[model samples]
Target: MKSSEAIYREALAQLQRLIEQATAQGVEEAHAAALATADRYAHPSVRMVYIVAVEEAGLLFFANTESGKGQQLIDNPRASLCFFWRELQEQVTLEGDVIRQSVETSDNYWRKRPRETQLAAWVLPQGTPAPEKGESRRQVRQLEQALGFEPVPRSPNWCAFRLQPERIEFWPSGWPRMRERVRYLKQADGLWSEALLSP
Candidate 1:
């Protein structure tokens, strides 16, 4: 049997290999594939998907407080997210900086949301105290009345922030730990360079 340390080392090796493949493929493709996989495994209660965005200096997180998932982001802004597509025996891992979405960007994404979602945004405080039951219900009713026939406007709180990825990893499961990994670093000229990692 592999020791705990060995298992961890194997995991890291797998992660490194994935990064290399993802980087070579391009960030956009990797993100799309990974997100799709994530959606499949996502639980209904997982309202916000953890995203790591880059900034001028470092990373930020965009996560919902409802499930306390934001706590993980806060504690470790640097993360390695795994997406496993069991049927294909494929997996991808992303490790990079994360940041919260800005109000403006959030608003843009908010506008694309369904009216019901927009209403829910207004009903929830997001990282703030939950309102009293009566008050909450009253607010919901008021919003419904105000928007009677028309769709509700997007809330300032419901926008998506930008996450600039510094690195991404992609790996397909196999024996001998010969997984493929790739890495990307945003250079001074704003171009990303891709490199392979040893597994």
Candidate 2:
């Protein structure tokens, strides 16, 4: 039998490989796991899900910047994210504090949106009462007419928010009902110390 240290080293190696593969594929790919789990669970909370982008001091969530959710982040910057991929049999849980996106960063992402979507930024009040559909459509049409061929302007509300992760836990479900769990705590120096937990 291998020594406990040897087994741990092997597990750590495998975990590193998986992380590298997931990162190379991008967060969107990681999000696929989240989508699959969300589909299976049919959770309403997952409807507007996003990968938690974290800094040392804040949490971030991104929307059209015109959506009510964006305003909520601006007002209250706390969030928790749960991600699961059934095929891979893995899950990640994250909780953190958030901050509003900087104007320059918001503008950068805003420019990438389609013109119609950019215009929609102005039509929505974000986190407020829903506007009448007919009235909203009319306003959009009017804006289109007024703007003619010019590019749509970014609303002051359009932006991204940043989230700082305080705690992160990774759970990998094993076959035959066995499972493995690891928890990481971020240090002041930005390093993480991981601990294994009983499954």
User: lDDT winner among the candidates?
Assistant: 2
lDDT of 1 by residue, 115-187 (tens): 7657767787576788876887788888999889986776543434333454445555666668766554455
Off by over 4 Å in 1: 1-81, 99-104, 127-141, 174-179, 185-193
The superposed Cα distance between candidate 2 and the true structure at residue 173, in angstroms, equals 4.6
User: What C-alpha lDDT, on a 0 to 100 scale, does residue 27 get in candidate 1?
Assistant: 42
Write candidate 2's Cα lDDT for 19-80 as tens digits.
45666656345533221111122332333455433333443446644444554454555655
TM-scores across all candidates? 0.49, 0.64
Q: What is the C-alpha RMSD of each candidate to the true structure, in Å?
A: 11.4, 7.8
